[model samples]
Target: MRIETALAAVAVFSLGLSSADAETPFKLGTFERNGRTFPGLVLEDRWVVDIAAANARLQKQHPSWKALAIPAGMKELIERYDGGLRERLHAIANEPGAATPRVDTYEVKALRVRPPVPDPETMVNAAVNYVEHGAEVAGGTQAPTPSPTMAPSVPGLWERPANDIRWTPYLFLKARSALIGAGEAIRIPPGRDKIDWECELAVIVGRRASRVSVGQAREHIFGYTLEDDVSDRGGRGDARHGSDWLVGKSHDTFAPVGPFIVPKEFVPDPQALAIRFALSGKVMQDSSTARMTHTVDELLQYASNILTLRPGDVISTGSPAGVGFTRNPPVFMKPGDVAACTIERIGTLTNPVAAGP
Candidate 1:
């Protein structure tokens, strides 16, 4: 809600890139942070360089469309429009004054990215979504007895004002203000070590939805992208896990998002996909979405049943196995480290760990 207030603080940001200068839609381009080289989609076909800017342009272009009173259904219409969304984006690529600062451009060049829908009003994370991860951490059959310490506890205990070590979703807000883009550098917090990474897919809500049925949950999702749920394992063993998690996970640049947002239409099935993480060129985690005990739809439906899902809300589906906490001596991120999370279909997100002063 303070978004309007924040944007108002800036009169204009300068970008030295020229517009296409014709009635062409901008192509979809993948971007990287800090000028790093990486793979990206160069779709000259059509796409909006910036959703907010395009909306303003659309209002000026066809007054008739305005009378139609269509909200920001551009994403939906783009999927079904004449040439489809990409095609339409290309058509208006050169629209005057509809361009955004190139500095914020999602280009292939090095630059930071944040959750497209940063500052999600509500956030939820699934627990034990990955069966194998659950098995590895809990050790089943062979170690039938539940680790008394591993049982789910009250939520928001990971890192909160108070701490409860009991296991649960242990959810907390990373503060929308703290989100940074993929390829951005993450500052290792002072007085903290044992850094950990949890690779998970994030879902963005399309509209104001509540009590959305499991069958209709897909309708609620606008798209999906990659997010690395970086953690502070040193904060473990606290009584109030949620409070601790809030602090541990809310450190600046803890949540890295984006490479390109693959809309839900592109991913008909959120399950049956593979997710992984690589740190400093070493494979740290590899698991399938199929391993999640609760599917995306299920997680959405479950969370909505409890609260209204507003547009831009985020749900971090649970992570797979191989967390640093479970290692022999435990493996945590150190200064000058590079970490990446790759989800099948969704592009991989990589970030560098810079030591704190």
Candidate 2:
């Protein structure tokens, strides 16, 4: 019963206009069951409350409250989240009894999980945002770094952002067609042998932002989710251009994202989180965001400078060192493989690998 109470407490935290009490923290995602797809509010990492159905019930119970239209999909929900909808969601989560699966709630394990945000306005991804990752994936096959030796008080390459102008984050646009959800199959294109994986921490933009500074970036952040920046090492299998950013990275099923979204309120420090990836239960890329050459704020600031960031837009902060193509023997993801990308405080995004038709 104590464990159950603790779970209820998470969704029941109060949000104040003055000096606030602890804010309620919850995850948002798109899930499917039977035949319909709906947005879900995940509580305590175990339960999923069907947003549309629960809100309807809440409104019926309290006629005094203004009725809000149910969102048709996840993207619509995110766009309307900050505007009156979030408070209604809070009401649904903070219902009288313990927060258990009720009429409109179900165990998350039972649902067919879809990408947290089905359609983002845009996906701006950073390239080589981690220093050591830059070194290892620079060119041909690489051997692992010799040791964790830092000249300072530590013995590692973990350091703060470089002061040079080179630290300005380089951003790329990813096609919306590439996105797939948790537990979905990552179809390896036929004839393209070298399939790689890059586990990254993706930032979900909250509001429409443009020209925002690093200091103001946090406010624009809606939440954080996991993105597997799956790559095709054999670029187009031809030297059409020096590099084929679109073809190499934009293949269908290349971007496996989300199980759900962890609101920024819960993630106090995005850079301090431990991000890792594993294949078929074997650890592959294990690193911390602490090693990022450019922090989330910087990337947000830079990306917003060039283009406006809309609600539900994803900015994949880039992956860490241990990529498959960087190994001496050059490991690659093949059929019958399962890749999982995990972030601290957030859940994992696992996708099964399969061959294309």
Q: What are the per-model numbers of colliding residue pairs?
A: 46, 2
> What Cα-based lDDT does every candidate model obtain?
0.60, 0.81
Best by lDDT: 2
C-alpha RMSD between model 2 and the true structure:
6.9
Candidate 2 on 242-305: residue-level lDDT in tens?
A: 8889877999999999999987767889999898899999999889999898899888888887
Clashes of 2: 2
What lDDT is reached at residue 154 by model 1? 32
**For residue 192, what is the lDDT in candidate 1?**
83
lDDT score at residue 167, model 2, on the 0-100 scale: 39
Model 1 alpha-carbon drift over 4 Å, by segment: 1-106, 110-112, 139-173, 236-243
